[model samples]
Target: MFGIKKFFSKEDPQQTEIIKLLNSYRSAIFPIGVQNEWISSIEKCKSQYRILITLPFAAHSQQKQLEQYLLKNKIKEVAIAIETSIPASYKFKEIKHIVLIASGKGGVGKSTTAVNLALALEQEGAKVGLLDADIYGPSIPSLLGLVDEQPTAKDDKTLNPMQKYGLNTMSIGYLVPAENATVWRGPMASQALNQLLNETDWGELDYLIVDMPPGTGDIQLTMTQKLPASGAVIVTTPQDLALADAQKGIAMFAQVNLPIIGLIENMSYFNCQHCGEKNALFGADGGSELAARHGVPLLAEIPLDIQIREESEKGENLIAQGIKVAEHYVYCAQLLSSMLHLQSAEASSVEITFSDD
Candidate 1:
């Protein structure tokens, strides 16, 4: 039997050891981080050695640390290529990842959570797009203060998605009158949503958040089947009734084999502006218990802040506005992003592709 290095001619002893060292090392972002598994292969050229690494999330620190370690090990003049793989159920030529934001019933601030989450993901270093899938009660146009604004067509067949607050947006409200009701049955609504998703030109999006209509009904089920969703996040209030419905939302995704990223508790509590006190107006630990019951993480507990409402109504997402309320959403965004990367790492295919600059 031949040794592993027998294939490569004049393979440097230090280079082989450095490769081993990289493979054994682990970082916080990837507790089991290493080369060989993450990297495709190491190539030895006359001028420079090249190694390609694919990561579920960007790790600038890890890259720097690895470079420094290689220098210390007397291994210089190496080229490192880093690329990302966002897990998806089905492949979209343009969009890399699609996340479905859902709720069991209406009036749980599902749309608000979806809007802020999209902005937060954009802030967190991903190209994000927002799709308003709620045909009957499309609130995205109103939330973005574009209820009167109309989307133009690139041609007779394609409609240009509207943009606001640095996010590409498509909504039924943009096409039809705000006051007018959708009056769409199941199949019609599903077709309209599919048309919006397929017809709009969302260019090279990292994350396309579909603000699903509230409920575990046809629209939600249809999207799970049609869209190549990376994962889903359920939104609910910190109330028993809301938590019960949220469980159903979790179960719905589970039934369709879509991974549940986590649960977000909207209006978890209220902060008294004057006295500087906290109030669990609905109930405490409801979302937490639901997450525990379903064995999913409780991602965030957003407060019922008036400013969040005011800013949202004014077409300014709190995350974009940089208000104090933005911190919670930002935290949630970070957690969501981290969890997504972790899940993708576990679920992604082993084939690695690299981009060199």
Candidate 2:
């Protein structure tokens, strides 16, 4: 209100007979393209102001995604203000029995154990999905003969999972081109993993087996934090070098508070192909010794066999082929099931379905 100027400027000039026109209108409504119109009209104002609008209702997860997008773009304010809460996407719920196959050192057949254990679970009849989260060296695609395949599109923005040996499978390599290697930093690798988990349609599953890379690195940290991991299985050969790394793996998971389901001594001993007698090529009882020190179960001692490597490398489903090798995986899987309290019927459903159905 201008005080001095208004008091002095009122003069004698006056005009009579003025009419005021006013109209009352109802609440405004618009068509489908209303947002486009609003955006277009906003440019005409040029001035800036802030106001808040309320959304009628929204799913908590969807609201969070919207908030994240706004923050990502550094949006200071919007019409709608929300207390967004996004629910995390997980492969399974009440998963009670997640088995992670990991190693501290490389080239120790951790992948082999992971693949075989998943098949063993499948054979046992649990709805199982395998996640090849080994960003450094994902061998599941090659080992399972899924190297050339890709996941199918389930929806416009979602992907259907691939199946191999009766296990729902998702792998980093499956999403990328074959010739291209996913050589990315930690954040990028995490994004890839997030896509694999959130975008893929992995329906109800009994167990989700994760094949972790061999190391106590960022990837390992990300997994232990992000995944609702039930337990882990440490695989190693019987040797000081492998055992040393195996100890690191055990410790890393322990540090993250994940339970060690058991220890598997792969290539523990060599049963002479000709003599049929056990030979301690690496050392004796290294895994058992380690397990004892760590206070865990020594689940299995898989002897070093040419057949095992050959079968894995050649894309053969060795668990399906009954042998000393297959039985070792079966027994290890059973031990894990018992420790994790996995269901017997769910665990043995594969055998039942194949035989009965």
Candidate 3:
């Protein structure tokens, strides 16, 4: 809890008004008096006030809204700090949330999206880790330019995650030769995934983004049941065939009672560099329609850009470089964090009390 008295007088009229406004704001719930840790400081100089706040989750949109509200109320300046909070987890106590990135079928650029999303979240000031859960065809190592790298053992029991671009990462690709075939049974593959997830020493992560294997199959079901995931982000192209498969993925998570964070439509369109015209190569609005029908947010409609492909092949971090398409990835990451916080808050709101007389 934060000490309000240190920053402002209890009887100050302006302070009181500001507190009321923050608590009443629906998008960014402050509850300053109770969960006062959200607020770092409040200072006043003449008629102007400067406020500093710290949020548990990334809420850039809400922060913008808050700034607008304060300015409208004649406040001179406002700053809201964002940080990652360790929400309760069913397992892996060090991790706050486990998010699986899945798709209905392959070739939709799910792995590439997962890599960029993880990097985007890190850019938003969260401690993030990436796990390549695609057993048979692990691509994270190659995607991150870590194909030759290997993870070291922290102890006899656990292995330290390989660090690249500030992300602690793990994948079977690190252990096996890329040229060799992973010929194994379903149970064997599942066991390998379990070991990779449980045995890695992911020290205190805000999010562990698992790049799940494409499709709704045995491995997918095994992970959905075994891991206490916060939710899943379904990645698909804006096409009828891809959308149909995406629906099946959604249904699988729903049947297991796992939440769907949202949907991401990759390869949504192509913007001609020469003409500056937007081309719907695959199709348009398929992702939005699917999301609307399922009551899930359409997180992003990533444009079909050649640079995105080129960079992925070279294992480069576009967000770090501040590329044009990086904005879309960052927006998706911000929304993902904000939606997770909203969902958690909504779930915690429901309480049942029992009385025995």
Candidate 4:
């Protein structure tokens, strides 16, 4: 339904005009991945045209660019709708979507990305939850300023999730002291993660963002097999070492038959506070090249801004304020939301019936 072939079937001259323009229009994420891939659809109401565009990920700048392109082509009184498609392992009753924020190795800013992304989704008008599944290094508590808060027991088997910045959250940090070491074996850690995931009252969430532990080890593998994730977002820096690890992360997900939503190139560059110059601190376009090579979207390239670091350390995510960094997160979240919607639409089209146990 999203390819150029549909437009040829229509007889209207204006339909033909739109089709010609769209043929030249390429998506930043899914460019040339599939032949005749129709990124947008149209519905006519009276004299106006309503176009609905579905993306593999979100980019606000791209949206504006497309609108401008259409306008320049003399398409007037056209309304555009943006949507996304994300793949899922399975659906959960309490949560509509489960997104894993993952990394192949440590020190890639995975936790920080997860925190900001979760808050950004909430800011973009979604009921969001953050799950600190990094058993060894649970940082959501510290990131959201919930280190002093503890969960209330809902029952013998379940605990209530803590609330902050309009997000429902659960973390291992809330259960243990900050300085206490987690001397947990693989099985013990996995069991604890399971309890935190299923034995918590998450209520009804549009998305439950899971901050996965680093590495391509037992914990990561177990979570991929166990969690009902809609998709995963890999976080990596622009350095060669980080990209190499990110490939392993992508491969691990592929091995588990998990779909990748996209890759977030965190700390891609740094902005000079005084001169307003952008310096490629790590490297240039490593993430973009990786996404291009792998046929996945490069969701966002977040700059290494001092404010982003400062606010995150203070448990005040920049996205919660009217900050510039927040805009990137908002676009990323919007793209993710569109992908999730697309995945849901595709899944629903293939209605299946399972035998009741």
Best by lDDT: 3
Output the TM-score of candidate 3.
0.87
CA lDDT of every candidate: 0.79, 0.66, 0.82, 0.78
Candidate 1, TM-score vs. the true structure? 0.76
**For residues 266-298, what per-residue lDDT tens digits would candidate 2 score against the true structure?**
998888878889899999989999999999888
Candidate 4 error regions (>4 Å)? 1-90, 179-181, 347-357
Looking at model 3, the pairs that clash are none
> On residues 187-215, what C-alpha lDDT tens digit does candidate 3 reach at each position?
77788888899999998898999999899
Task: Please give the RMSD of candidate 2 to the true structure.
Answer: 24.9
Cα deviation at 167, candidate 1, in Å, is 1.0
User: Which wins on lDDT, candidate 2 or candidate 3?
Assistant: 3
Q: How accurate is candidate 2 locally (lDDT)?
A: 0.66
After superposing candidate 3 on the true structure, give the runs of residues whose Cα lies further than 4 Å from its correct spot. Answer: 1-7, 10-37, 45-48, 60-69, 72-74, 78-80, 86-90, 179-181, 350-357
- Which portions of model 1 miss their true places by more than 4 Å? 1-90, 179-181, 349-357
TM-score of every model versus the real structure: 0.76, 0.68, 0.87, 0.77
Once model 3 is optimally superposed onto the true structure by TM-score, how far is the C-alpha of residue 141 displaced, in angstroms? 0.6
Please write out the lDDT profile of model 4 over residues 174-279, one tens digit for every residue: 9987445278878878888898899999988878999999988877999778999888999999999999999999999999888898999999998888998999
Clash pairs, candidate 2, are 53-79, 124-347, 124-348, 124-349, 125-346, 125-347, 125-349, 125-350, 127-206
